[model samples]
Target: MLAEPARKFQSLAMAEPRSQQRLPKRLSRLLVVGFAVLIGLMSVLVLNSVLNLRAQEARVAGTVELRNRKIELATDLLMATYSRHNSLVYQTIVGDPFEQDDHFQQFIKWGYEVGKARNALRAMRLDGFETARLADQDALLARIVELHDRISDLARQGRAEQARQLIAVDLRPDNLKFIDSVDQLEHYERDRIQAELDAARSASRRAIFVAVGLGSAIVLLACAIAYLTYRQMGRYADTIDEQMRALEQHSAQLKHEATHDPLTGLANRSLFYHRLTEALTRAGQDQLKATVLYVDLDDFKPVNDRYGHAVGDSLLQVVAGRLLGSVRTTDTVARLGGDEFAVILLGVGEASRISRFEEAIRANLVRPFEIDGAELVPSCSCGHAVYPDDGVGMDTLLHAADERMYAAKRARKGGAAG
Candidate 1:
């Protein structure tokens, strides 16, 4: 007959499960938190990479602009230099027939302008241009300079007529040839600039396309991760909520078990200490007096020694009930240990109130007990300690009360006539 009940009890025990089997709420939260953290980290990386790419693209674009400007300046300089050369040669050759007053001045001005243009070309051209092309251009420029010098010398000798004749023979052909060569060099430079522009444009287009593709991929990846993480976080949140509910219930049950004495269903030592601290805190805050009544059973050990541990336990339960009945509902009574109990009065009016509470506790503790229908008697020695006056802390108050209880016990022993 007992076998069925035992099996049912076993089933109940199994159904209830141990505390270890429950999943931790923190673990679920950690998974959600970790996923969010990783997603945030990845998002940051993607954004930083995109920004760096844009910065690089901007740098490339700036370089392209600078290269294009160089091409423009070089082209303009070549054209200006060529024009100056044409004017110089034409004036020296043809101006003798016309004999214009501005002929020498025009020649000198053109020479200066051409020189400036050549200097600009030298400054603007790329270093990597073919050495042979550069050398040919330099040779042509030198020839132009020499031809101008020859024309200048003829004019300076006051033989304008002879200068004109020499200009027709020497100045015109050399000037035209130099112009043609410079034209060729300009065309070559144009072609090179065009190629560079084309290459830069193509690279810019490719870079922009690559950046767009990569940025899109990163955004899509981030969105996908966010979506997945959101879904996962939802599940994790539910799991955590369930675990939290379970934990709260478990915690409430544990609180109940921890605070109450198992034998007498009264407050245990932990609860008493907590209540004492709270009472003391309130007393300090409100500037009121709080009392702690320390009670230790006097003859209870004799009962345990004469009868047994079981009988002593029964007597203690009886004593706890009487003690609880004697104190106000607001007061806290706790079992410290074997035959030891403490009471915390929330708001004590005065020192006399503590004396009255001690009197009530002693009266109840010394009352007779009926255990298993057998008459028994129990007596307890009491001690009173007040907070913020006699002691400032829980430990100090308890210690003071315990000392008084021991002192009372010694006095009673001395009066026993032993």
Candidate 2:
């Protein structure tokens, strides 16, 4: 009956003490949560960086590139103006009447180039300052063009001196004024480009600083979460180990309590039956003789009545100790309850050895018990039933031994009465 629990307890005891390889459930959850938090934080940072880069790419591709293209067109206008001025100067120096048509043709071609450049600039979207500056430059170019037209007329009519003189008197000063105006527009556009570049760089630096700060914070936060989780797991593992150890000790105590007598600390009735059954089986298989001794204390109720149950319990303990001392370690001694005790002896086929066994038990149990300042001498009636000579089965052998013990008790009472 007690075998199953004892086996379970034995298995539990044999297991390594408080060894836990698996993490606790709560700690596992905490680690999972920490991992998720890290993932979430990193994802946000990456997504934000991606978005910012995309925005910067859009600005660079759109407004900034367009503005730079506009600056290139302004530079083309400046180059065309300078080329027209050089063509007018060359026509002034080459003053042959026949070459006049050729120089005028060349002069008209350079003028067309300047007009084409101005038209292209006007076609694009222009700010107020760019429009006003372009208009002012156009007015100055018109004055220069009017003077060239007059010089062209003089040259074609064979008035070469008047054509050459018209250059210094009007054309040169007007072209110089136009050059200054174009330079002012170029400087303004260049300043705007530089300002735009500076703004972009400052924004980029701010974004980099913010991204770095947030990334560092997230990394530190993840590390802190990880460290806390590790510490918690350690504490949780220790707690689980402590509980496992406590349960192991409790199971061992329960196993002992289940099969042994509380007061005498000997095998109780359950264990007694179990041992007797095993002994009978072994002795029968070996074809060897075994002995069962059923012992009942004489006048044990009087001792309990005289000295109280405490002394009775003490006497029983002393009797159990003596019986254990008298027998070989291989033998079984048990308390069947109250003042009754039993012993099982296997492989004891000799008649002399069985007699010596009984004598030793009787001799030891007859000694005085001293407990709580009360000293008492006790006697017991013992009966033996040898296996096969008595019975083969466990219950049958036990019943035979019990009946013999009662018969001995009756004989002792008769002798006392006489």
Candidate 3:
């Protein structure tokens, strides 16, 4: 049973990599398919919109064509009535037999053209008002045609005066009424065409609005998908970058701890030598001299014995602060070992400058330290060696500074004995 369970666990562990790899591939395919569907949908909408626009164009065109044809028919009917009226009046006035006959023939041809125009108008679609106008015009034309034929007969019989009297009394007035009826029909058709065009335009605008709305929705959906995909792919890289930054900070902290002292948080023996070496190298390059101060606390062992290690450690930390304050930032101060500190002051070209700096260090140490309800005076013995004057190398400078420290201690001991 244990063996079977172990094998199943191993199989699950092995399956994870394959699943992880397939996940991205599946997501990619899904994204491609989604875009394809969106594109196809957009194309369909565009195709539908295009078809709608073409249909609207055709509708408007047909409406205008009908209006024009109807107006042409009305114009033809009016012109034909005018021609017949003038022909009847002319036949009654003219004395030449041939000329009167010619005018009569022209009148008949114009009347035939008028009938054809009416027939065409009736075959077409018309508003209720237009159909009523046509009926009124037809009644008027029938009366006018009867009066005209009587006038033509009177002219042919050479009773021209009677024909002219009939034309003045009846035909002229009826012709004007016929013209009015045709005008009404033309006006009605114009209004109808404008309404049809307006409807077509409204439909076109609605189709366009719908297409724009759908296109914006598709664009927003695509953007959302793209954002999700980008975030999904970048998550691991972001995590790795964060962890790398943390590791780099940890490595930096470890390196600092290795090179510095824990008690004072100052440079230790190893870093001090490194700094001293760099300072000397710079001094050698520029032909400038550097200074080294080896600091040792006086009676520190007695203080530790009297005050306990805790108080002694606090005092050491306080002394470290004072030493750091005494030097410029360009200078280096280090805790070499217990109660022992060293300083390297670069570009201190003249040995005379050391006295002023030494006075500053002594002033800070001279002040009493208040710790654990006790006022204590802490003093240190500082012995310094100058570059190229004592020796150019670090080891030579260190040895010379150390010897001078003991010599100074001995001189103080002798003076106190006196």
Best by lDDT: 3
Give candidate 2's whole-model lDDT: 0.72
Estimate the TM-score of every prediction: 0.41, 0.48, 0.46
Tens-digit lDDT string for candidate 2 (268-335): 87677668778888887889898898889999999889999988888888898899998999999998
What does candidate 3's lDDT look like per residue over 1-418, in tens digits?
8999999999999999999999999999998898889877766666666666656566666666677678667766655665566566667756789988898898888888888889999999877887788889779878987887888899999997788667666775786677778767766766776676567656655665565556556666654544443343244334334443553464457447656889999997757866987999999999988999988888899888988898899999999999999989878999988888999988884657888787788899879978897677988777899998998755567767877876777777788899
Q: Tell me the whole-model lDDT of each prediction, alpha carbons only.
A: 0.64, 0.72, 0.76
Model 1 C-alpha lDDT per residue in residues 1-418, reported as the tens digit of each score: 9899999999889876654355566677887786677668666644554455445445544544554354444444444554454344344333344443355566567567656755665665355553454566677668767866766666555565565556566655665565555556545644654454455445444544443444345445555754543443344334434543553465456446656889988887656765876888888999888888888888777777877888889988888888888888888889876788888887774867777777887787777767766678777788778877787855457667877877787787788867
- Off-target runs (Cα >4 Å) in candidate 3 are 1-229
- Model 2 scores a TM of 0.48
lDDT value, residue 67 of candidate 3: 76
> For model 1, what is the alpha-carbon lDDT of residue 7?
100
Off by over 4 Å in 1: 1-249
- Compute the lDDT of residue 114 as modeled in candidate 2: 77
